[model samples]
Target: QLGRCRSVKEFEKLNRIGEGTYGIVYRARDTLTDETVALKKVRMDNEKDGMPISSLREITLLLQLRHPNIVELKEVVVGNHLESIFLVMGYCEQDLASLLENMQTPFSEAQVKCIILQVLKGLQYLHENYVIHRDLKVSNLLMTDKGCVKIADFGLARTYGMPPKPMTPKVVTLWYRAPELLLGMTTQTTSIDMWAMGCILAELQPHKPLLPGTSEIHQIDLIVQLLGTPNENIWPGFSKLPLVSQYTLRKQPY
Candidate 1:
């Protein structure tokens, strides 16, 4: 992943990709090998509270992960002082987000299957290692020129051997979030990833999101409408959700 040791000033910036809450990603090229790479520079020093915890989590987790499906964190370049941290990573051709958006035609079933199987394999490897990728949205899936899928952004990811609570709602993206998580459960499970996989799988048919919800509540409603609402008996500790007891159900009331 870390190609040549680029001096912070060595990489020439091609252009800005997107401005995220934590940092700005740029497509940069190494002066030595002329190899293009993605540079993620954290805005830690300028913040009032200090370095964002999310950035720290990303750095910590990515450093430990060494899977072919998972994004590789090449090196951490210490800037003039400790304020600026530059993460070097392999150059991915595009993310699933960009691919789906730009594709004027629908993706073939085989193409979708091939892409998702790679994602699942990567996810399976992560789960087997006891690492949970809290964020498993299509945007996080990156592709290589060889059509390899590498899961990026381990900012929300964590290592756990079963949580003390139920499922974690705070982990995944809203649209792809799991029912157990949406119910405000905090127990982390491989099922959460599977749920996101379900969303991803559905998205592949037309290269669009399957259940795109505007809010968490709406997302839960869509799930109930599809799979039906879960009960404390079937789901176990269903009433324990912070928001669950508030509403009465018309269907599958248990």
Candidate 2:
């Protein structure tokens, strides 16, 4: 039982690594096993009772997943205070986002291919299991010192149905968000993740975000600039989308 979970005292915090939507992650060393691990401190300070839905989903989904390209969650631990819970995860040297931000040169096409292949493999597994990674971006992709890429950050992930159920479009970072999502479409599928993959691939080539829009309308405009305006002829049922009439689209072509 996680209630009787081991205290976070078993791990020695090395340094703060990164922050996610649900928690703050730290690089730590397991005192008992003498192994480095990522300790994500679950954010529950505001919750008067139990875990956040995001944290709970991450834990439940990760517990059922086992793949080389997926980040591993080892165990859960609690801090001195009741709300200070932590998740022990496999440690990675860096994330793709940080690497892209810091690297002097952009990754070569071959290198990008390697990274994309790993991401696709991970996505394939998740999709096969009926899971949709609502948030897919370079920041959520981690890399080991050995160049192995693994998908991390499952806070926004959820299981999908074959018929495609309605979901929140507010998920995913704005830059990598899909056009349908931007148009206020709540029907989420693996296509949303695929759209993010396309953005990631483009970003890898330039070593920067493919579409860094200032706002939701600007985001749609950027997509139009890249892929041209969509019409009913190109994208069936485009005009009938809930938010399609909210903005006047620019006449642009890639």
Top of the candidates by TM-score: 2
Across 1-254, the per-residue lDDT of candidate 1 in tens digits comes to: 12443456777879887544367788888787898988888877557775688888788888777888888887766455556667778878888888889988988889988998899889988888787887888888899999999998776777777434444467788889887777666777777888888998898777778778898777877777777768766777777777787666548443
lDDT of all predictions: 0.78, 0.93
lDDT of 2: 0.93
lDDT of 2 by residue, 1-254 (tens): 66888899999999999998789999999999999999999988679778898899999999999999999999989988777889999999999999999999889999999999999999999999999999999999999999999999999999988788888889999999999899999988999999999999999978878999999998999899889989988899899989999989988753
Report the Cα lDDT for residue 7, model 2. 92
- Cα deviation of 214 in candidate 2 (Å)? 0.6
lDDT of 1 at 241: 70
Specify the poorest-scoring 10-residue window by lDDT in model 1: 1-10
Quick one: best lDDT, which candidate? 2
lDDT of 2 at 173: 95
Tell me the lDDT of model 2 at 1: 62
Q: CA lDDT of 158 in candidate 2?
A: 98
